[model samples]
Target chain A: MFDVSRVQKELTECNRDKAISGVSIALYEGGSDLSHLRGTITGPVSTPYEGGTFLIDIQLPSGYPFEPPKMQFITKVWHPNISSQNGAICLDILKDQWSPALTLKTALVSLQALLSAPEPDDPQDAVVAKQYLQEYPTFVATARYWTEAFARTSVAIEEKVRRLVEMGFPEDLVKSTLDSVNGDENLALEKLCSS
Target chain B: MAPVPASVARQAELLKQDGNTYFKKERLGAAIDAYTEAITLCPDVAVYWTNRALCYMRRKEWNKVEEDCKKALQLDSHSVKAHYMLGHALLERQDYAGGIKELEKALDLGRGANPASYMVEDIWQVLAKAKYLEWEDLSSKHIYRMHKLMEACERALTSFYTIEDSQVQNDCEEIASERLQQLEFLKDVFGKAEQDDQPKEVPDYLCCQITLDIFRDPVITPSGITYERAVILDHLRKVGKFDPVTREPLEQHQLVPNLAIKEAVQAFLDKHGWAYKMS
Candidate 1:
């Protein structure tokens, strides 16, 4: 069984300095299960991933703290060490190098650090890694584009939905379309038009 | 008949004596009541609070004991009884680090006050328990810190064993020995975790494709892919009943323990224990 008390303590500790740490954790919306959580981490400054707010799905195993937390990116991003297709991170701390002392906040901080420093040699996405190593400028441009295209869109959902509705699409349809395309206004409009 | 007038201090003294009498008679509630009355009469006296705390301790009321002890300490910081009681209360509450600090302070004050009156051996025994408990809490967190705590436990154990008090010696020895066994188990687990901090390349075949860690108990799936038994079992049970690498449909029974690979991993671990930390 999961140690609910420890998980509760970790959640409190992580959220206590959410503003300062730029990382916060909340209970996964559907249920009261403390084992599943939703985490948010602001991208580190002075990096291609900066100004992007990343959402992460966190699942705690029964042996959590003893066992490493299962974390994957819920928000799309472009990084050599992170799978562009599935968001599987290639950080050691998420796997065999995980220590029980590490909390959710620290793990998210590490993810932010990973954004700043991509280890292309130990790549999760081979194509991205190749691009990163062989076409440094192009890789930076593509990563910056992905962040702008995917990451920032979540913040403009209200505006996007309003604009789509003003363009004669139903409010509910606009809302669902925006969510389906991860809050991308242009894509949601195209999806609405196509439907 | 002569009318006798008692001063507030004298009245408090009389009440304290009554509390002591009740305490010796094992009437803890009555003892507490008497101590409360004494405190009401002499709020500035630290002894009343310490005496009440002792009564609370007898009743196994750790929080009450802690409160009274804090009150006593506030009145007179040098009160050894207050420190001792507070340490005992904190220990009972499993605040080992805080308890240890308070006990250490009591020991220091006890030394200055009167060495003969100090329960030196008992304090050492409690200190050892606190150190061992602290190590237990830290073992899962950080291997290096756990190693340091283990060393602290060892030092405390050594000191505990040297105390001349024959009354607690046997009990302390038993506890110390048990703690040592626990420490050995933790050492085995943490020794490997500490190695993770250092960069060491393992032979590729030694690592499980699923976990990317050296195998503890290697097992082969029907798909001909080898993995650590625990990792594969976890994947099968939770994630999916398929090969993590190949995505081939699989089941638990399809897993056969690869003894040859297991033996190799064992030999490797036996040779270099530090490389086997991911338990």
Candidate 2:
């Protein structure tokens, strides 16, 4: 059987230091089960993706910890190694090189690292990879534009969390629930009550 | 057996001393031989069998350990080492229920021993793993059964609307309500198991890095990193042939039972069985 207790432990460990780790995990919007989760990563500094708050959808297989957790970008990202259409990442660790030693936090950090150093050679999106290799300036502009369009919701979510916390919900719970609902205050409040 | 001759008993004592020396030096093969000779000279001595069981345990000859421990227990029913070794042997063979019972017996026998004796703590360690394994297995099966019952309830409720007869429909509705309450009760069991959700985190090292759950059977690698035994074995077979962290070439045989960590985990659970519903 897949180890749910281990997933619970990793979730606790990963979210212990959210500010320092620059990554966090929460249950997906409507699911109470532990297998499905949402991961957030602060885009690495000095990269075009920097300052962006990226959301990754995490699905743990039954052979999880033995198998790599399936991760995809929910918030659209423009990187050579990430498919712009569907946000599929072509990272080795998530595939053949997966190790049980690596937690979801490490995988998210690796994703952030992939953002900083995009591998255009082994590309998930050939169009983006071509832009990255042949037209570096255009690549940077498109990546930055995509980040601005899709990933700059950290401040908005923070504002929503502040409002929800003011409404007497616990800050951490409100924060996670608010982000998962995509900043819809009414949906978050409804979801929080049920959760 | 009849009382032994004095010189023959003395020779048996001398062989036991030789076995002790061999055991201390980690020469389990020679220790087993010495203990065998000691048992041959004085078959009634319970410790001679238990000591040889230890040597067998060290060699991972679990069946031999089981046999020797059984013999030791038959000779001296109060032999704690016999129960402990037998329990461990049973666990190695996946007899969790029997292993847990034997470990509990060992615990009952050893709890009031002197401060210098570590047998109580050792028994607690094995007991803890045994209990945890049993709890995890049973709880998961409980969840699966509850889900099936819930699905049955849903189907009955859905079909309740389609029934032409009012009497049958009312009976179906009643059963559906009972099933709903049953599902609630099952959910509450899970809720109660996780009752202490505030300000408690399992210590990291007590957990396997792979699964992050508490160790069931911990095995240490050549590089000193430890993992839950089943997890690491799966990694070796399904993933790669090297250590995940150190990247050192590792084989299945190189993984040694990490008794220290296993004991620590067992101790922790023994103290806080309420946290995980380990009892």
Candidate 3:
């Protein structure tokens, strides 16, 4: 479980700050006992994601404070740091910027800033990152496309992987085999599981 | 003992070679003795540490493996095999994150970048057996056999499954039963290998991609060893042996890491903000 007070304090601070806009936030803790901790962020006026109500999922690590909590995008966006398949956000602060001095409000502000101007050089999504670096326009267009496709009602990759699995193959084989085949979900499970 | 002869270095090298030979032959006990003797003769050499670490690894003495690997690194931090063995030792100890770091270093130092194809068949067998165990009941061994038979039938749903004909189910059941028995015997003989041996099935291409991914860093090739930094290049060239029709290196068909997986893995490092180096 996380320090709920700290998270709440951060949420309140972000809400009060007008600059931090256009993002929705939600917090979850205690893996099995998942009670909706909180969620709220408005879309920013500036940036490509402007007018977009981006949903953010903040999951506290089993050991919070000592370790950093997880922050992912629940709303689909074409950011270099977020996976298009799943709204997995790649943030340095969330992972490495874990100073006790930094609060959830500060993290939210950072994420909002990231939306305005993504660090193309240091991207979480390599494909997007690479394209962003090499061909900036294409990356932006793709990001926009993905945002339109996924951000409207963002879904998780696990659901997609599960859907593939339900087609008759074992989950373990599906994942392992899909990885080797490099995202080809239609691969025959028999060939993958064969000795 | 008055003065160390020039031949002493040569003698130590010879002993070290002998230890490596034994290590390769899987005569671990002898390899250990030979490496020990070489170390006793010349305590400063790095290869001696490497040779002894291999022996320790064969014996499953992970602590000693780590100790020897560290010693080798201390003597020569650039030694690729030293880092590779260190990664293996760390992995055996279930220090996955640490092990991964060491392995990344090993590739950076020019050791084999990816898990070799040699590891695939064995790893698969192990995974299959584990899956078998999981699917099999704790209550009855015979019932377990029956379940495995059903599982094999389901596997036959695709053309990739080799078993054919009307009696295929019974034949598969018989083959699976015998193999499971043999596997149990092998486990007893080897004194418990890892549960899922399935060769990490890390594709040769993935290994190449990972190698390219790690090598793409500017810091990797600072001292004019840029192209040769990732050991995967050599392994990739060697993958020619696997192809009979080509009869030459499969240089063209190889998949280089496109910018995405590279950035993702790098982001993983950057996001973790974890610091790591070759040593």
* Per-residue lDDT of candidate 2, residues B104-186 (tens digit): 88876764443344375477667777776676666567657766776676667556644734545355677767766866775
CA lDDT scores, all candidates in order: 0.77, 0.83, 0.55
Candidate 1 lDDT tens digits, B162-197: 573454546556776776786677667667766664
Q: Candidate 1 or 2, higher TM-score?
A: 2
Residue A192 shift from truth in candidate 1, angstroms: 4.2
Candidate 2: regions farther than 4 A off: A154-195, B1-101, B104-126, B129-202, B260-279
Model 2 scores a C-alpha lDDT of 0.83
Cand. 2: chain B TM-score: 0.61
Q: RMSD, each candidate, Å?
A: 24.0, 17.6, 24.2
Q: What's model 1's overall lDDT?
A: 0.77
Question: Per-residue alpha-carbon lDDT of model 2 for A1-195, expressed as tens digits?
Answer: 567867887788889998998999999975898889999998888889888999999999998887899999998899999999999999999998888899899999899889999999999999999999999999999999988867886546777788888888999899778768766678999999888
Query: Ten residues in a row with the worst lDDT in model 2 chain B?
Result: B270-279
> By the DockQ metric, which is better: model 1 or model 3?
1
Query: By descending TM-score, how would the candidates be arranged?
Result: 2, 1, 3
- lDDT by residue for model 3 (B1-279), tens: 354466887888888888879878899998888888888888778889887987787788989999999998988997777777787777677666677577666644442224442222222222223323333322245445545754564454433334444436555577667655755564454333322222222222222222222223221221212221223233344322221112233342343434443454455434222112111
Off by over 4 Å in 3: A1-195, B1-4, B94-97, B111-264, B268-279
DockQ of each model vs. true complex: 0.04, 0.38, 0.01
Please report how far candidate 1 places residue A155 from its true position, in Å.
Answer: 2.0
